[model samples]
Target: MTTTAHTPPAETPPAQAREQFRAGLRRPTSGYSPGYAQVNLIAVPQAQAFDMLLFAQRNPKSCPVLGVLEAGQYSSELLSGGDIRTDIPAYRVYRDGELVAEPDEVTDYWRADLVAFLIGCSFTFEAPMLEAGLPVAHIDQRVNVPMYVTGTDCAPAGSISGPLVVSMRPLPPDRIADAVRITSRYPGVHGAPIHIGNPEELGIRDINSPDFGDPVEIPEGWIPVFWACGVTPQAAVMQSAPELAISHAPGHMLVTDLPNDQLQVP
Candidate 1:
């Protein structure tokens, strides 16, 4: 999936990608629809909506809110012409906080009382990273990025709370600053590196064994850069043991109509 500086790969349009997913194509979305925004999905019952919203408000780094769909809603400006329940590549369903199923489409499991939250995803910034001549290891290796649940705890909100989760990318020492500057522009998309260097400092015991997503090769001399992940809410749902929750499987995302640059700051 590596692309040249000026000539990026042929990107699939946002609507077409959604159509493919709607037709049941399953895969991680890191490089899909390269220039459009991609978001993490977390849907919960109406009763738990406020707690989830408060949780996101308290943990903005990991769960920056992009858009929200009220109870019984399955579409919005972010996902025009698509159904939230079935447009993603894959979904994880949780009952009482336990992951009960991983399905291609959740029409059978989706509830009318659910409220869906679209949170920013790091994938939204990967194209910029690649365009900047920085290597994105997971895309380079054709695997999903590695993610770990750090020992650090997020500030609790109402009944929702959990440890912070982070996605990692290994980069050369010389390029770290460029990667940071390129990514920092898009704060709505979990902007910037939260921690750089040793994973142990973030309480990650084994860099090779990630709690979520597939691990990619870490070339020698390349250091790991960690970014707060949208998966944080899923972690909260599991720890708090909510009665019902639906989320995109780790690495799988909802590609949206919005352009990536739309989230960038000056």
Candidate 2:
């Protein structure tokens, strides 16, 4: 069954949004819990923790580390009262580097030797962009942002490394500069556009077809802008082929209590 995009009520609190997810609301989190930060999640065995940390360090643009929870810990001090295992809408389980299951909750798969990493997501910046009157196409279309695996290769670190992944948004030629300026204030999120215009330059053969997430309409005179994605780490984990790894399903994120302005650069 195809799931239509549904925007969460404007007054919904972060806790309420998470409660909805905990109650089995499996939907893309693009427009939920307005003004709160949303994060990407990846849980790996402690044995692979060092490599994962190095991977994030080497690819800061794509894998900006937000918080790291020690082995078996589910809650994050950075996001007070946030629980990692049950807060997200959907979870992807990878066994031997292949996706094995997409579950609503990962409580059953939790292991004492697992370490969870929270990565900053671009979704955190969309609010400011919208406030600035810069159009966010996917949100308008009620779909997930389009993402692609780029030809760009991330710097290798220990056992983890892979091609950079990017999320795309089409902006009016006139509004592109303003969009960049608005997003540049949030370095804790994705920061700014890594590439603008010409998907072919990024080795994306078809702009209409994306490696992850759904495609949105690119109106006439709009140019595609690409931003570094937190999902890059998932691609790296897939390449590393660890014994077990867990991540949020594409477009599903861990909504946190931290406000979006908290991530703005000084």
Q: Tell me how many clashing residue pairs each candidate has.
A: 0, 0
If candidate 1 were superposed on the true structure by all CA atoms, what would the RMSD be?
Answer: 3.6
Candidate 2: C-alpha RMSD to true structure equals: 1.3
The runs of at least 3 residues in candidate 1 whose Cα sits more than 4 Å from the true structure, single-residue gaps closed, are 1-9
Candidate 2: clashing pairs of residues: none
lDDT of 2: 0.88
Give lDDT tens digits, candidate 2, residues 1-266. Answer: 12457664576788888888888888899988898989999889999999898888888889888899999677866556757888899998999888888899999988989999999999999999989888999999888888999899999888887889999999999999998898888887889999999899999998999888988999999999999999998898788889999999989989888888899987
Which tens-of-lDDT digit does each residue in 1-266 have in candidate 1? 11111212368998898999899888888888888999999999988899999999888899999999999888998989899988998899999999999998999998899999999999988888988889998888878788999999999988899999999999999999999998899889888899999899899999999999987799999999999999999999999988999999988889999998899998
TM-score of 1: 0.95
Lowest-lDDT window of 10 residues in candidate 1?
1-10
- The TM-scores, one per candidate, come to 0.95, 0.97
